[model samples]
Target: MNEEVENAFLPMTSVSSGKGSLVIHDVYCYTNQIVNICFINIPNNKWVLIDAGMPKSAEKIIQGAEKQFGKGSWPEAIILTHGHFDHIGSVEALAELWNIPVYAHQLEFPYLTGEQDYPPGDPSVDGGLVSEMSPLFPNHSIDITEKLNPLPADGTVPLLSDWKWIHTPGHTPGHISLFREKDQTLIAGDAFVTVDQESLYKVMTQKKEINGPPAYFTMDWDEAKVSVQTLRDLQPELAITGHGVPMSGNELTRELNKLAENFDTLARPDSKT
Candidate 1:
């Protein structure tokens, strides 16, 4: 008799890879691989999905949603923070699977419709293997024209009455963050993540910190700095960033303030000695 076996290494998942938590009673945050996706509940069994995870993660996201909202659960729509590969990775799949519309800032329409592609990432700007590996990530546009819709100019998030979408560009021309004025809870996209995303070790360990957008992918340092300042002005009591675990209260305040005050040192790659 003869037997054969296969050998392989575990997945690239982080410590919090498959974990989730409730930032509030109705707002749920789940990590899909390295990126975080939000499920915001609305009354009458309705909910919205904010940003999709890494590519080919549609199945995982759907399963998580089913487990979150129970069987047969589907979001009213998908809200894109930007057209970057990581955030919208599973978007096309999820939208097609559920036949739902996808909303994005008009500036992002070109990228989503395959009209334009983002510039290749700048690996020379940051420290980490992830940064060095940036050249491999796709900077090309994705086609999702039929399912795409422009976000409202008034800032109101469709289907979410109390929440507003704030334009937070720099990570991308149309990057945006969602905010709930009442609780001061913010769903900040890559405008600023809660982890040093360009650092492979930090990303893998899920280390928490208030860092600017991934250095390799950020196109405009000046714009990114202003975006962070704008968010800091909001004084959010809680923030669910695109990456890393959710941060709230004083920890969030202190970290955000420090990040804003020292962005040149803390975030700007060119400032490093």
Candidate 2:
């Protein structure tokens, strides 16, 4: 593991809510500004991980899980909202170690099964250093064909019945978000991010700002705009995005609305490659 990553994921303070059965674990990665990996703890020792974070953060992820569920308790399965390198860096390693199955949208199969490489990040298209440095982001596919399963035909994700998977692509061809209708908790992948991920300073400080997906990897600007609007219509009460701290209540709702209304202006690509 990289020294920076080792320090970044050092065991974080854990919090549990007595009112509800849900538990959320946040894991941070030190590269490309700040990357957050979230794990939702449900019943029966089963947990749902939203994204995989940067490479080698798996050890820390497992450690976080153990902190909540006790040592040696691995998730029944791992569900990915997308297949971006940061989100999938440690997927194969973690899945192999735990001998667990992995789930993703069928549209994301090309990347996960080593069938296709996502288009390279467009650094010149955005001004932020993260975008300028995006050429460094990995675009190679992972060969996890055997352990992968597609979302159920009914659109309900396994182990998460109350939640529905929303195909919020554009950040990547098959990126997705998870939504629980009952209480409206959204786990937005990269369709839209709650932080200006390209700004290293803002990331390190944990500043709150809702913005488009990480500019480095976002391919289709128009599609991305529509996706953000679609998610806003859901009016999620709480959102845990791929980056930034999880947000909730009227504040999130207000930001989402503003994003949807001005998507073309705010989410448009800075330049065409």
User: Can you write out model 2's per-residue Cα lDDT over 105-184, one digit (the tens) per residue?
Assistant: 99899988877888776777658766776666677777888789998867798887678888887787788888888788
Each prediction's whole-model lDDT (CA): 0.86, 0.72
lDDT value for candidate 2? Answer: 0.72
Candidate 1 residue pairs that clash = none
Q: Candidate 1 residues 61-101, lDDT tens each?
A: 98888888998899999999998877887888889989999
How many residue pairs clash in each candidate at the backbone level?
Answer: 0, 0
- Model 1 gets an lDDT of 0.86
Q: For candidate 1, which ten residues in a row score worst on lDDT?
A: 1-10
